[model samples]
Target: MSEKFQKCVEDFQCLNCGQEVSGNGFTDHCPNCLYSKHVDINPGDRANNCRGILKPINIAPKKSGYTIFYKCLSCDLEITNKTAEQDDITNFLITLKNQ
Candidate 1:
């Protein structure tokens, strides 16, 4: 069995807005605003403690940058991690730009 899927709900305080968020077994963003904190190196790992605000900014193609564009809301730092469903807009723009 996968430990991640078997894990129970966990609550985390939104570092961006000080809002307490409940992880509904599979949640990774603040439902109130869709903002995510840089808390884990991987989903549900809880290994990272950067506590930085992860904001969705831009998106690049799949092979070049690995995924979408991510900017740290707190320090304005830029990073590119894997993309999610919410990355549609950025992906579309990147696709157009590439063509």
Candidate 2:
């Protein structure tokens, strides 16, 4: 089966910080707290049933930009997302330092 790479633009409240986040077709994590919900198995496919709160654990420098690492608090699954333009750089730095 071929994976569909679709952009599922949807606004949702952050499960961790209760922040209202607006999705710009690619906005995955909350810009305020950098928290994301484990809703998609593929990039915006939303096929995953593990609806766990994705907690920001660390940040790593990527060639394109930076990637934020997340760990599912409920299921212990790890996920990574490339840093978004609207993401909080301050929080990203803090996460990088703590790593």
Candidate 3:
């Protein structure tokens, strides 16, 4: 299998905040709430079947951008995602504070 994260662009409703999120081909987390689902083992592969809610727990600065850390509420799995350009500033700040 190819070890690359696929670019799957699909809109999904935020399970945590109940927001109708529009996918931009690279959107993984909800822009309004910054919450993501534990759907993929790798970036857009969607091979994993955990299907848990990934809650934003912390943020860390990286060379390219900020990395948002998440902890799965159901499975206790930890994951990280890069900060998107369209991410909300207020939510980003709130994540930083909670880190």
Top of the candidates by lDDT: 3
| lDDT of candidates 1 onward, in order | 0.58, 0.81, 0.82
* Tens digits of per-residue lDDT for model 1, 1-99: 533433346788766556687776555655443457665666666555476888756445675333545677766667555544432354345544676
Clashing pairs in 2: none
Candidate 3 regions exceeding 4 Å error are 1-7, 95-99
Ranking of candidates on lDDT, top first: 3, 2, 1
Residue 9 C-alpha lDDT in model 3: 84
The digit string of per-residue lDDT tens for model 3 on 1-99 reads 864444478789998788898888788788877899887888878777787999888777889667889999989999999878877747657656777
TM-score against native, each model? 0.47, 0.80, 0.80
Q: List the residue pairs that clash in candidate 1.
A: none
Candidate 2 minimal-lDDT segment of 10 residues: 1-10
Better of 1 and 2 by TM-score: 2
Mind giving the per-residue lDDT tens digits that candidate 2 earns over 1-99?
765534488888988678899888888789977889888878778888787999888878888767888999879999888878877768656765877
Worst 10 residues of 1 by lDDT: 83-92
lDDT, candidate 3, residue 86? 79
Backbone collision tally, model 2: 0
- For model 1, the local distance difference test gives 0.58
